[model samples]
Target: MEETYLLNVEGVKKKILHGGQGELPKLQDGSKFTFHFQTLKDDFERTVIDDSREAGMPMEIIVGKMFKLEIWETLLSSMRIGEVAEFWCDAIHTGMYALVSRGMRRIAEGRDPLEGQKHRCGMGNMFDYHSTGYEDLDELQRTPQPLIFIMELFRVEDPSAYKRDTWAMSKEEKLAAVPVLHSEGNRLVLRREFAQAAAKYQEAVICLRNLQAKEKPWEDGWLKLESLVTPLVLNYCQCQLELGEYYEVLEHTTELLQKHNDNAKAYFKRAKAHAAVWNEREAREDFQRVAHLDPSMAAAVKKELKQLGERMRKKHVEDRKRYQGLFQSSQG
Candidate 1:
C-alpha cells in the first residue's frame, strides 16, 4: 500500500524521500531558496519533464516574490535545508508550469526570455506563438496534467542575506530603476562605449517589459509602458549600428517601424543597416521614406544616396571584370 502526507494546500500530497537535519527555516517575503528539482509526469512511466541538476544549476525561488509557479514556493516552504521530497500537485497548480519552464529554458539557452514577446503581454504571446518552441513544453501547454516535482532543498537565505538583482525587484523598484539605467546608458554612449551602452539600454527595456507583462495588452497602461520602451530600444539599436551589428539594427528597427510608421529615426537607422548589408532597393526605399517623413533629413538622405550609388557602381564593375576573366579562362 502507498502512503502520502496531504499538504496544507488542497489537491497536493507530499512524500519525503530523504529527510534533512535542523529546523525549518523562516519563510518570509524575499527569503531565497535554492534547490534542484526534477519535474516528472505523474504517470506509470513518471516521465521527466525538466531537471535543474542536469542543467548544472539549482533552481531558485524568493518567497512572496509572485513567481509564476506559486506551488513551488509552497512546496519549498514545507521543507528543511538538505531535504529531498516529491510533491504531487493537481493540474490547477501545474497549469502554469509550462510557461514558467519556457522562461527558465530560454535563460538556460542564453536567450531573451521574452524573445518573441516584443510588444505583447505573456498571455498574448502564448496565444500568438501557440508553442514554447519545445516539444514537451508545447505538449504540456496543449494538455494540462498533474505533475510530480522532486525537489532537493539545498540553501535558504534570509531577505537581507543577499543582494537583489533587477529580476528580483518589485514592480515599483523596477520602475524606479529604469530612468537611472537610461541615464547610465546615455553617459556610456557619450564616452563612446557602444557595447556597454547597448547593455544598459537593453536592461532598461527588460525592466519595462517585466512591468508591462502585468498589464493588459494594448490597453492604456500597457501602451504607456510600451511608449517608454521605444526610446530605449532605439538607443540600443543605435549602439548596434555603431558596433556593425547591421542585422540586429535591421531587426529592431523593423519591429519599431511596424508599430510606429511615422518614426523617422527608425527609418533612417534601418536605411543605414540596409545600405551596410547591400540591400540596395530596401536602403533606397527606407531613405526615401525618411526624407518624406522628415524633410530636415533630405540633405542627409541625398548624401547617403550619392555614396550608395558610387559604392554599387564600383561593385558592379568589379563583379563584371571578375566574370569576364572567368569566361575567357573557361573558353581557353
Candidate 2:
C-alpha cells in the first residue's frame, strides 16, 4: 500500500505535511519549491473542480476542506529519509499551522477560523478562492498571496550606501566633494547663510544636471537618479526665493512649477515672486491655482487675489484716463 505524509517548510509552522509514510523528504541545496495545499475540517464538503470525479481518497476528500496549512507533497515524495526542507510563508498562515501543531496555541483563539487570519478570500477580498475546508477558511481570512508577491517584487532599496558615499569627501575631491559641498551650503542657509546656501544649492544642481545629461537613457541607475532632479530644482528655486532674488526665483520657480504643478506651496510661493516683480497677471493666475489645489488655503489666498483684482482695476482706469487726456491735449 502507498503511504503518505505532510512536510512543513521552515518558518512556515502553520503548515504540516500529511503524506510521508516512512522517511521524510530530502531538500536539494539552495533549491525551493512553491505549491498549494488544501485543508480539511469536520464540515468539509469538497467542491469538485470536475463534477464527474469520485472522491474517496483522503487527498481528494480533504482537498476542499476548510483549514490552514502549507504542505510540501513533492518534497515528501522525493525524500530519501534524511533531507531537510525550508521556505517561508507569512504570519497568518504560519500562525494557523502553529495553532494546529502546538494544539491551539491560545485557548481564546476564535473557532470561526477567519477571526485572526489577516488574509481572506471573498468576492472583494484578495485570494478569494471558494472554500474547501475549515483550514482553507483561515487561509481566505489572511491577505491574498498575490499582494505579497507584488510587495516583494517592488521592494525599495536601502539608501545608506548613497548617503555614506556622498558624505565622505574633501573639498578638493571633485568626484566625491559635490554632495558634501551641497550639504554645507544647506547648513549655511539654515544659519541664515543665504549667499553660501545659494552657492551650494547651485553646485549640487549643476552636478546632478550634468550627471543626468551624461547618462544613457537605458542605464539602470540613470532613470532612478533622473527622478531626483525635479526636487533639487525646486529646492534651488526656494533658496533663490529666500535670498530675495525675485528674478532668479522667477526663472527657477517657473521651471519647477512647470514640472510639478501639483505642489500648492510652490504655486503660492511663485505667486509671491510674481507679485514682488509687479507681474500682476501671472501672480493672479498662480494664486488662483494655489486656492484650487488646496481649498483650505483659499481664505488666505483670497485676500491677495482680491487685492490683485483691485490693483488691476485701478491700473485699467488710470490707463483709460491717461489716454483720454492725451487725446484732449493733441486736439488742443
Candidate 3:
C-alpha cells in the first residue's frame, strides 16, 4: 500500500516497491539498520546525488540517534529486512541532508568539508551561504527541493549489537574513542599481546584519520591532530616490531619521521626493524639518530647493536661453513 503520509510524521510519502521478508524490524531506540540508500533530486528522471550501492558500502546507522542527514530513519523504522522502498521527502525533512551531503561529498573528493571556516553545528551551518562546494547541494539549499530516497533494507541488529566499537560510531563518538583505543593498545602491549595491541592502535589511527579527513591540511587543527597521531603511530610501530612485521614498522616509522624528525621513539623502532631485515648500515644510522635525539636511549641502542652483530656474525659463519663443505665434496 502506498501511504499518502507517514504513520505519525506528516508531509512525507512512502511507496513500497518490494515487500520485505518476515516481520518488520523495530527501529526504535538501540536498534540498528544496515541498508543501501540512493538520494536523488526529484527531477523527471530523478538525478543522482549519492548512491550507497555505487560506493559498495552499506550504511549502518543506530536508529533514533539522529546523528546524521537522517530523514529516512522514520521511513526505515516501518521497513522489513530485504524490503525496498522509495520515499519523497519535503524540504523540512531533506534540508539537513543537503548540508550533511556536502561534507560527505567533500570527503569523497579528498577535500576537507569543514575547510575555510570556524566550527558551526550542522543545522546552524545549513543556513550559511558559503555552500557545500557542490553544485547539486547548492541547488538543493537554494530552493526547498524535495528529495527522492530509494532504500534497500539489509539487516537489523538489536540493542545487543550495540557494542560501541569503531565501525559502529558517529564522528563525535569516534573522536572521543581515539584516546580510549590508544590506551587499550597500551595495556595490550604490557600484556605482550603484540597482534592484539596492533589491532587496537590501528583502530585508533583509523578513528583519527576519519576525523582528520574533515580538517584542512597544515591548518592549526590539522597540525594538532597530526601531533596526536604521531605517538599512536609510533606505538603501533612498536607492536609491529614485536610481531616481526619489520617492513611495516620501517614503512610507518619512516613516514612518521619524514613529518616529525625529532621523534626519538620512531627512530628507535625503525632501527629495530632495519636490524631485523639485515639492513646493517641503515640500522646503524637509525640507532645513532636515536642516541642523538635522546641520549637516554644510548644504552638500549648499544644493547640492540650487540644483539644485531651477534646474529649477523652467526649467519656469516653458517654460510661460510656450508660453502666450504660443498666445495670439499665437489673436489673429492
Candidate 4:
C-alpha cells in the first residue's frame, strides 16, 4: 500500500494518493478550478456512486461559488494541477453531494442540470425536505453518509478568466436578466426553435414564480409580478402546442382561463389543443368564447371550424365503414 497520510482541510479528511508534478500556485476566492471527480459510497471504494470521468467531462467551479461540496473547494485549494487525491468527506460536506452530482450528471448529458427544480430558493433548499424526487437522491437525503472523492486537479483560473452565463448568476441577477431572457425567448420562438424557446420561457417563469412566492397572492405586488409572467407563460404554452404536448397545453390554459375568463389567447390556444385531440364540443365552446371575446379572431375561428367540420365528417364515414366491415366479418 502507498504511504497514507491524513490531512484535515476544514474538518474534512484527505488521504493523499499521488501528488502531481509542479509547484502549487496561490489560490483565492473567485479562482476557477476544473477537475474530474469520482464519488464512492462510505468506505467501500469499489462501489462508485458518481464519476465525472465516466460521464466524459470534468466539473468546474469558481472558488467562491460553492458550486459543489465546500470541502472540495478546500481540498482543491491545496492541490497543484495534475494532482490526484482521495478525500473522505463527512456528512456535513457530503450531505448535498447527491444534488450536486445530479446537476453534474445532467450537464454531462447536455441537459439542463437545473431542469424541473429551478424554483428552489437556494442551494440549501436542494437539501431541504424537498426530495429530489429521484430515488437515489432521496436515499442520499435520507442518509447523509460520508463519501470518498477521487479527484484529478485540472486547471485553476481567475473568475475573469471565463464568461459567466445566467446559470452562474445569483437570484437578483437572474431576476434582472428576465427581460433579456424574455426577448431571447421571443426571438427563438420566431425562429421556430420551439424546444429552446420553451426553455427560455420556462426559465423566466421560474424566476417570476420564485419572486411571486415571496409575496402574498392577489396583492398589488403579486399581481404585478403575475402580469409580467402572463405573456411568458402563454408563450411557453404556445411552444408546448407546437411540440405536441397537448395535455400540458390543456392543463396550463385551463388554469389560465380560470383566473382570467376573458383571456382570448388562452381560449384560442386551448381550443387548438382540443381540436387536435378531436374534442369537438369543447373546442367549439372555447372557439365561440374566443370569438365573442376577441372579434378579430372570428375569421380564423371560422376557417378552423370549416376544416374541423370536413375532418369530422371524414372520420365518421371511416368509422362507419370500419364498423360495417367488422359486422360483415362477424356475420360470415
Candidate 5:
C-alpha cells in the first residue's frame, strides 16, 4: 500500500500492511481500543524498542483520556478493526514514547506501572530522571528521534461495554470513589467476608495511588496521600492474614515498614506473618521491634511471642515423630 499522510495530522505517515474490514469505527471519548504495537527506530536497522505482543498482551488505550502517547490514539483512529499498519511519527509525536514504554514494561513485569512516576510531563520527567530504567529508552530520551510503529488493531469497545477501572476515572471521580470503597470494605470486614473486603481495600488503595502518582514523590501532597493509603494497606494485609495469605501479608507489611520503620502495627503484622511462615528468628525480631516502637503493644507482643513459641514447639514434636517413624520404617 502507498504511504498516506493522516489528514491534518502533521509529521506522521501511515501505510497499511494489511487492509482491515469496514470503515473506521466511531472513536468516541471513553472508547477503548485494543491493539498490538511494535515500536521501532526509524533507522535502517529499525531496532525494536517495545512490543506489546512480546509482553503477551495487546495494549488498550482509551480515547480522549490524555494518554501519554497521543500520537498512538491518532494512529489507531485512522485504522479499521483487524487492520495492520505502520506509521512513522516525527520526533515531536514520538517524544513521549519512552515514558509510555516504561509504564508498559512495568505492567508487563507485574509491577505498579505508576510506581516511580512524578507530577511532571513526559519531557520533564525524561530530563529529571535521565533514564527510563531501560537502556534503549534512555538512549532515545538522550537523543530524540522519529519512530516507526507497527500496530494491529484487534478490537474496539464502547465505554459502556465494561466497568471502568481506577485508571480510567477522572481525578475527581477517583477521589470521590475512594471513601465509598473504604466504607464498603469496612462493612465487608464486619461481615467476615475477608476476600471481598480485601478487594475493596485494594481498589481504594489503587485509587489513592493513582492520585498520588500525579504529585511529586515524598512531597507534602504525595506524603499526605500516602498516609491515606497506609490504613487501607494495613486493612488489606489484615484480610490477607485472615485468608492465610501469609506471604502476601509479609510483602505488604515489609513494604510499609520500609517507609515507616516506627509503625508498630506494621511490625506486629509482619511478626505474625513471619511466625505463620515458621521464620522464628525473623518473627522474634519483628515482635521485639513492635514492643520497642509502641509500649502499649508490649502485652500483645508478649502474647504473640508465647503463641509462636508454643506453635514452634508443637511443630518440632511433630517433625521428630515423623522422622522417627521414617527411620523405623527404613530399618525394618
Candidate 6:
C-alpha cells in the first residue's frame, strides 16, 4: 500500500510520499528525518504549485508577477525521501506578505504608497535602525518590525512619543544637529554637497589634530588623529578642487603627499591644481608621479603631458621668432 507523509522542513510545510493507504507520519517542528524508500513502478510524481490558496501553506503573490513556487521546487529537487532539510529564505520570500500588508495599511491611512514603502523598508535609517525617527503621515502609520517585535516580546511600556520624536526630525535636521561634527560632514558628503560639507570635516580634523598635538607622542591620541585626519584631508582637497579653489586644493594635496608619497589621488589632484595655475612643469611632475603610483592612469597622463608639451613648445617658438623679428627691425 502507498503512504503519504506531511513534513515540516524548516518553516516550510510540505507533503512527501503521496498515495499511501497506511497512516501518514507526523514530523514535529525541529524534528530530523533521514530515510530511503522505494516507489511503486506505477506511481508517478506530480507537481503542485503551492501558494496562499493551498491548504496549510502561506505564500505571497502579486496578480501579474510569476509565482515564487518555482524556487521552492528547485530547492526540493535534491531532497531524499527521508532526508530532513533545513533552509532559510530572505525578505523576498519570507517578508513579502508582511511588506505588502504594511503598504496596504499605509494607503488606508491616507499616505502615499511610495513614501509608505520607503519607511516600511527602513530606507531613511542611516545609523541605528531603531533610533531612526520618521515624520509625515506615512511614517506615523508604520512601525519597524524589529521595534515592534521587541515591544511585544518584552511587554515593555510603549515609547510611542519617544519613537515619534526620533523619526519626526528629518535626515537633514538630524545631521545638522548631530553632536559629532564628522558625522554631519559625512552626511553632507553623501549628499554630494561637498563645499558646505568640507567645513565640518575640516573642523573635525582640526579638533582631532589639536588633541593629538596636546597628548604625548606615545599616547593613543595620535593614532586616532591619523585615522581621522587622512580621510578628512583627502575629502577637503577634493571639495576644493570641485569648487575651483585650486590654491586650497594644492595646499591640502601637498600636505597629504608629504605624509603619503605613494598616494595616487593626491598626486592627481595636485597635478590638476598646477594645470589650473598654468604651471606646466609642476603639473607634469605631479602627473608623472600619479602615473607611476597607479599604472592605470599612465595612458591618460601621457596623453595630457604630450599635449601640454606640444602647446608649450609651439608657444615658445612663436615668442622667440616674434622677439627676433622685433630686434632686427629695431636694428634696421
Each candidate's root-mean-square deviation in Å? 4.5, 19.7, 7.3, 5.0, 4.7, 20.3
> Which of candidates 1 and 3 is the stronger one according to lDDT?
1
For lDDT, the strongest prediction is 5
For each candidate in the order shown, give its overall lDDT on alpha carbons: 0.90, 0.50, 0.83, 0.81, 0.91, 0.51
Clashing residue pairs, candidate 3? none
Give the TM-score ranking, best first: 1, 5, 4, 3, 6, 2
The TM-score of predicted model 1 comes to: 0.76
Model 4 has how many clashing residue pairs? 0
Indicate whether candidate 1 or candidate 4 has the larger TM-score.
Answer: 1
- lDDT by residue (246-312, candidate 6, tens digit) is 9999888888787778988889889878877778889989998989889999988888788778877
Tens-digit lDDT track for model 3 on 106-198? 666678867764556666667655766777778878776788889999999886765855545677778788888988999989999989989
lDDT of 2 by residue, 243-314 (tens): 788888787777776656688877887897887677997998999999899999999798888877787788
Ranking by lDDT: 5, 1, 3, 4, 6, 2
In model 2, which regions exceed 4 Å deviation? 1-179, 216-223, 295-300, 303-332
| Residue-pair clashes, model 3 | 0
Cα TM-score per model: 0.76, 0.37, 0.63, 0.71, 0.72, 0.38
Estimate, for each residue in 213-279, the C-alpha lDDT of model 1 and write its tens digit. 7899899999999999999999999999999999999999999888899998899999999999999
* Among all candidates shown, the one with the greatest TM-score: 1
Error of 5 at 281 (Å): 8.8
Superposition error at 147 for model 3 (Å) = 14
Q: Comparing 2 and 3 by lDDT, which wins? A: 3
Cα lDDT of model 4 by residue, 44-118, tens digit: 445788888788877887767656566777778778888888877768878777787777777777888777774
